[model samples]
Target chain A: MMLKKVVVCGVGLIGGSFALALKAAGAVGEVVGLGRTQASLAAAQQRGVIDRIASDWADALHDADLVFLAMPVGQVASVLVSMAPYLSSTTVITDGGSTKVDVALAARQALGAQCAQFVPGHPIAGAEKSGVAAARADLFYQKRVVLTPLAENTEAHIALVEHVWQACGAEVSRLDAEDHDRVFAAVSHLPHFLAFALVHEFAQRADSAQLFGFAAGGFRDFTRIASSHPEMWRDICLANRSALLVELDAYMVELMRARVLLAGADAEGLQAMFDTARTRRDAWLDGLTPPGE
Target chain B: MMLKKVVVCGVGLIGGSFALALKAAGAVGEVVGLGRTQASLAAAQQRGVIDRIASDWADALHDADLVFLAMPVGQVASVLVSMAPYLSSTTVITDGGSTKVDVALAARQALGAQCAQFVPGHPIAGAEKSGVAAARADLFYQKRVVLTPLAENTEAHIALVEHVWQACGAEVSRLDAEDHDRVFAAVSHLPHFLAFALVHEFAQRADSAQLFGFAAGGFRDFTRIASSHPEMWRDICLANRSALLVELDAYMVELMRARVLLAGADAEGLQAMFDTARTRRDAWLDGLTPPGE
Candidate 1:
């Protein structure tokens, strides 16, 4: 086996799925799920997502060669701090947090001299569902996994983390933590926030039922992300506050421009804007081969 | 056949699909395709979306029992005005325009004394694809078709339109022209505009390629409507200006509130907003039995 023992913290969709993928690839000797809930860890073990359950990181870390923090962004720092006391000098740590800048900082603060082993990462794959029950071994297949290795991280540590992701059938790429935060804030975080806002605004309306009744496919697709886990999104938004704010402002500016065009009845101008977007979006869609395709 | 002859003006996706659906139901004696271009007309005829091509509405209306103006919103008025001179007193008229208020007003002005036969409708069915080639007989199956009958419309005309839609396997409902415009502006037009704006904004960014490269399924689904026909959306926006402007302002207000919440790092408030949206969206999705489900 590539690793003697690997611990997956949180044991939810991302954690469970990662553990299962690692086991399927035979990349580890033993996969232990570490979570706050015994029931969830038990479920993960029963489903073969993990070979064993870790009641606490200390016990799990004693013989572990690798650690994966697949928990919510809000809890990543505290967990890192708690486990730092037990982490072996040879063990490598990586995370599946959506925001990297804060996560990298948290690892640095929590692990101190051992920060070189902690690699901040985000695997861009998910569904509306959550929990260990929703986990699958193929969840990361053909998906993108971005790693923002800290300045303190050694080349060997980075390679080990990248190796795990590659074995899981994910395309791995590296970016600076700040750059990762900015790009994802614009593409992922902002869109999720806007979707939630759209749904909330409609629900607050007096004719909400009528408005929702009239909403068709477009509305459904546009707001589908609004159905995501609330606490997860909340943590993402708060963790990547500055970058998300910048993106939100940029998006607001675009919305205002559209509003001006509509208010002025500028049909030609509106058509030009929509045409540009259509052409670009179509080209982008043509490039992507979705999973089933 | 329930009807002696039916003429489908424009013969694009909506027009062609409607014609095919009616034909599949054996609801019409002869379906004639009318368009500005002979290529499109011939394409529709070859695809069996229509039985024959009409060189002009004058000849097409001679024995027509019904006429469907399935053109862009901007052309609906002119087409109705052009066909008015040849419309028989017994001929019933309906349109598949996205906006209702303007179409209803146009029909009144164009048809004059014959306004009683015109019904304005907005079918809640479509895809990113256009043209007769993309048309399908089952496009409207299990979809909602909203009709905004003019004050001058006769009960018989309304019944005929309802019967035709029902024959197409659509759930038909009635709404006032103004209310229809208001609700659709909020749900449809606003969402389309926002999606287009999002794509336009991102495309204008210096790192657009990288931004798009990292976009996941949520981004794809949210902006899927951005690939819609530009001219079609332009006409809808212009035709429904007043209501659209009102909805846009309301949306801007909501956006600004979100901005404030984010700027202040109000985690509790943000979570509350996201939770509300998640609950409502989940409920709505649970209620829907999507196509083929």
Candidate 2:
């Protein structure tokens, strides 16, 4: 299915990559960029990520087949409110936010009855670098794009979002908005928070320089996610606070168990836990698809 | 200052890599291997990592200018006791154990007066894959090798060990045994335990497959260290229990701080903490030397 005109609200990594992928796949007729800054929109257009820059939401959404809100979670509510008047009844909408429930709530409050056309999605692909300049057409190829379909979403609207993601070479999956937030809160958000906490712990130490100087490969890999955008992570942690708190509490229990094993000098127990973790991680990695497949 | 004979006890990744590096540098004449299994020693010899497999400590230490105990921290005490009778005052002995304080204590208790000949050291270089087959001549090149010299250790013996690591192209640093344990407990051991705990937590869940399925780059990198050798980590953690427990407590406090911020929905505080972490990690990466330099 071809989209006549796709309006991307934020022309950064996710939005720009989506526009580029749809354009490359010959799935979209025209990609129009709308963002906070004209300079960023102009940059996206110059990079061929967008056909043109829209002066306003009405201009961007006029006759638009799809409108993608690809911004941080904190920005989603205001953007949804701003575009609600311009949103055409015929136009379907989706998002690339990290958290789903909050975005769904915002869409419901802003779009009201028109919320039936909105699909909340999160593309599980990212790099240490971001922004329009880091965008690529193949970013989502073989990647997972999870669509948390709200009860209000029509079958046709959901299918349209799924078809567009498939055209971008993504394997699309569906889940309830609450389930999506809870799953990610466990797998993604908790790890990010742990990493950030570790780095913050080290940085605040009196002998931080000495500790960092001694850190090697294990430390580097374990804390790599700690270098993620602070504002984005803050928004995600706050948006999914309840589920994340549950995960954090559960993880603390696990850590406390580990601590007991260590404090008591139980080599057998510690080895058992480590063995399980290593075996599970190795198996997971083995089952993963090779890159660029 | 070239070594006439160097006996490597384990002939695994660390031992084999040391032998290969010394050979590559033309700094040693003969590399002898000694281990629990003849099969592993034979494999190391076949890979050209060792000149021959030693029949016993008597044979391995005979005329050996250097002896390297590259076995796990758990085995260091028994190995030191086994080799003490064969060790010569002229031979400078060192180790590649992760923990230093315990190893130094083991040397002192096992070797008695001969403890002066032993230097406790840790080469902070490793890969997820281990064993002799994974060894490389350049594994320690441009890496950090920290030595914790005992008061019983002669300056000459310490220098000899340091010189050999330098010959292997590693930058050597010195710290007190207590300080070495504390530093690594924070930087390396804590991170490994956290990764292991996180992965184990996910694996034990009823919906683990679903959680692992949705885990992306952040989770992958954050838990990469979870795939490390269980036995090795078990030995390290048990050997460095005191310091590791202290680190764990400090980290728990940090996690609690983050938890409070999330639970309170304190976006500004959470963002500030994340900002500090990212800024510090970025600075650390920026200051790090590029690979293969």
Q: Second chain only: TM-score per model? A: 0.97, 0.97
lDDT of 2 at A111: 95
Per-residue lDDT tens digits for candidate 2, residues B120-160, read 99999988777999999999999999999999888888899
Predicted candidate 2 versus true structure: per-residue lDDT over A1-293, tens digit per residue = 89999999999889999999999999999999999888888999999999999989989989999999888899999999999998889999999999999999999999999999999999998776668998999999999999999899999999999999999999999888898999999989999899999999999989999998888988988998888878888999999999999999999999999999999999999999999999999999988984456
Q: Which candidate is the best by DockQ?
A: 2
What lDDT does the true structure give each of the candidates?
Answer: 0.90, 0.93
> For model 1, how does the per-residue alpha-carbon lDDT over B19-42 read when each residue is reduced to its tens digit?
989989989889988888899999
Off by over 4 Å in 1: A289-293, B289-293
Model 2 stretches with alpha carbons more than 4 Å out: A290-293, B290-293
Output the worst ten-in-a-row residue range by lDDT, candidate 2 chain A.
Answer: A284-293
